[model samples]
Target: MSQPLSVPESHPPPALIVVMGVSGSGKSTVGAGIAKAISRPFIDGDDLHPKSNVEKMSKGHPLTDQDRFPWLAIIRSTAERVCAEQAQSGEVNKGDRPAAVVVCSSLKKIYRDILRGQHPASTKMPPEDDTQERHPSGAHIPATAALKTYFIFLDGTEKVILDRMSARKGHFMKAGMLQSQLATLESPEGEEGVARVDIDATPDEVVAAARKAVKDMIGM
Candidate 1:
């Protein structure tokens, strides 16, 4: 894992944590573990993908950028909705934010920017004009300020990931797609608010390392 960045003492905890990597990199497992440890919800990005994307992947086709924009938008909106609901629950303390862990491949830097609410063209959702108040229904508020997002990148070799993928069953993403994903991936190294965790260890070890990385990042 990379060295933990020096977060400012006054920085608020992340309101959305994205566990990102190529397929078969244990994003769902590690993300769920982190969410459980942090007392937050876990969302699988695959589950959020539209039916068409799933079908395309099931046929061994890689998703194009146009195919992913809408899906990324949904993921962003979901994170914001979770944050809004948590804020309204009155359970979170002052100056602290409610958080959720989500699994997304998030291969490219542009995709990551969209998730951070930095790319307006990627999503039509408007930013939160007022963070103090939210809709009564806890709708998709798209409050970038209220939702401080971070990414836990599960990094590993393509061979290792493909081997694991071959052993798995009932997953739409085939081992053949790993190459495309690697080609599309823009390493998140040196990017702000990203922590890279090596996935070569056992699942438990990886989870423990990921949790520690997250705690260290958020100053927990």
Candidate 2:
């Protein structure tokens, strides 16, 4: 009889990173590149959305709050599982380094709120946005030792992002939808545990800036 191999009891925590922006802002492309550079797994938020949601988006219809509820739930579950897995494991293995990056259009404060709520105790002090009032309760659950939850806001001029979207094809989100996305977008500032980087720069430059910004925000 073959002997059964014993699996390790624990592993390292995964980073619960949300690569967010409106359509045409390069969330998926930049997220994949960042995941590769960091040697972590990347989960495109598009893939997590239900077929109905995709259909709605493809039809140029914007998703309502209802449409996003279940989708965001899945994201939360995945993040929770990754964190639990790491907690069970003593230390993070190179193989286990959190590679889970979710590329989604986390456009509004409400949308970001759902993701941030996963770790209730992790919200830093509220930023000084007189226009914004809803602040999450506490610090979010730590995703990995390297990060609790890292948010990357891909900021770019409307013309630039619109132009890039116009050139891309086959994606469900069309360039025509860019205006709506822009209308819905909420800018990230300090105290949201987010690192904002301009997308007007080259991809390498953007990525470098993103990394530096994230590290600076989290002290990682």
Candidate 3:
């Protein structure tokens, strides 16, 4: 951790990077940018949400911890699966960079913890009635159990986020819910492997800052 932040063009081994923030903080955009820059597959957390959750959000309801537990599990599983594939194939396509970038809101610390292979007390629950249960324990990403899991938080102002969300259309998340999302978000300020980048700059600059912070945290 004492090393300088900047690395050469090369990057470290494939780590699970969750480009996390509230709905409109550019998680998907900047996450995709980072993955493209590092040659890893990008998985959007929004796409992983169950239809019930999406419908609820689209109708202006904030999801409960229970609603999010399964979604977080899916994102973590995607990351772990990709990392395992890279390891099995013995591919270093990005010079040690991780094989996947997960783009998700990851609003709460417990959610981030779940993504990092730890179950929070509040989020742990027994299997539901459904056959396709999506709890964290049900869909484990074994490769991530001992790997470096990083959270790249896209910090932004409430005004900025509102504007971005308002401009979008046909998305499950509604602008009216931004306030709740902001309130629910627990910033990854002191968490290890957490990187914060202000969202005031161009996408390229934001990605650059994210990489520098990641390099500093993981010593790339």
Candidate 3 local lDDT, 2-106, one digit each (tens):
111122245454478888998778787888887777767788777767666777999999878898886676666656656656655555554665457888888
Off by over 4 Å in 2: 1-14, 51-62, 86-91, 94-99, 118-147, 167-176
Residue 28's C-alpha lDDT in candidate 2? 74
Candidates by lDDT, descending order: 1, 3, 2
lDDT score of model 1? 0.73
Worst 10 residues of 3 by lDDT: 1-10
| Root-mean-square deviation (CA) per prediction | 7.7, 10.8, 7.4
Q: Taking the tens digit of each residue's C-alpha lDDT, what string does model 2 give over 42-73?
A: 67766656556667999999877777755664
Q: How many backbone clashes does candidate 3 have?
A: 6
- Lowest summed lDDT over 10 consecutive residues: which window, candidate 2? 130-139
Query: In order, what lDDT does every prediction score?
Result: 0.73, 0.61, 0.70
TM-score list, all predictions:
0.77, 0.68, 0.74
Tens-digit lDDT string for candidate 1 (5-119): 2222343544679999988899988998998888877887666665566779999998778777756765766677665556556445556657778999899988887788765
